[model samples]
Target: MDRKEMECRLHERFSWLDSLDEQNSVLGLVFCKSGWYNLICEMLTEIEQVYNSKNLQLKSIDLYEIKEKYGTMQTDVGNCIPEVYEIVERYEAKSEGVCEVCGAEGSLHDIDEWLMVRCEKCFHERKRRFYKRGLIT
Candidate 1:
């Protein structure tokens, strides 16, 4: 799944994500790879269930950002319950062992100072690209 397709799925399934399309919206875009698509969807589903169970308005929660940083997933949300935070944290931590490219079992690697999680195949493919670009010798 590409970013646009994944994003469309999220927006379509979660009306609470309405803010993502607005101007001046913080983290207005999904800044991550397709590999983590299922992970993100799962996280959002759990959050939605939590809100539904508690009779909370899902739109009341503001999703500020969702991105990858330092080889893990990160979500910045506002006005959500504690369970939401916990769920995000769990998924973020889990991202460390999942490939950012192909979603296979992976480990964190630093390629020319860029931190990313990748299985051996994706890692080497990225390294090869860098070498070809003269970014690495």
Candidate 2:
């Protein structure tokens, strides 16, 4: 899903998120893409109870999916609050190597100049399709 949709759903699930956005619209926690959103959502849902109870608020933090060579990936939480950051780290560690297109086990494959997490079969198929569409040659 897109960032706005993700944020809207997140705000709905946890009303406290809206307050965080109001507090820091500049940062306004945004998820880059599939590489991070689902995992972050799961972690945030789990931690929401404690986070709110402790009166610890998450300011606008940007979580990014870092592209690397096949099989390994990384994410940067950009110096957010310690508690929220810890959850980000946990989910991101898993997402880095997971395929972005399909849920199958994958690695960040470099097809031409593009970076994507795709299994061997999917990677080849995508490359072929891209070539046919003149997106890659």
Candidate 3:
């Protein structure tokens, strides 16, 4: 199939992902475009990576063949991908009191203790600005 056709098929494959229940079970019949089964699997694998990291499972319906046999009902697809839960997990893993400016972790290097505990990037920028103004030797 052509690129547009392939994209449409992929879109249809993912479209069915939305109507699934919270438990990941299919709430209704799933469907997709013809000759794009592998593409659908690839997309599912990508989604699995992000979801698996957060210990969450994504429910998917294998409707590639079904769509080929039955055909797609709608032409336009919708935006309904599930939220990436791994980001929250990653954020929670960060050290407490970490400096948002410089990524420095620990209360000892906090702004109150050192005037400012900027991250390495921010520190360099500040120094560059200070030298430009002849404020520091």
Which candidate number has the best lDDT?
1
TM-score-better candidate, 1 vs 2: 1
The TM-score of candidate 2 is 0.57
Of models 1 and 2, which has the larger lDDT? 1
Q: Give the TM-score of candidate 1.
A: 0.90
TM-score of each: 0.90, 0.57, 0.25
lDDT of 2 at 85: 65
Off by over 4 Å in 3: 1-30, 59-137
Over 9-30, each residue of candidate 2 has an lDDT whose tens digit, in order, gives 6667755443344544433455
Error of 2 at 124 (Å): 3.7
Clashes of each: 0, 0, 1
Residues 1-137, candidate 1: write the lDDT tens digits: 77777777778788778655355233355889988888888989999899999999999888877899888889988788899999999999999989988989999999999999999999999999999999998
lDDT of each: 0.86, 0.59, 0.40
What's model 1's lDDT at 119? 95
lDDT of 3 by residue, 29-78 (tens): 32432223443444355555665677654553232222222111121222
Candidate with maximal TM-score: 1
Candidate 1 residue 62 Cα shift, in angstroms, is: 0.4
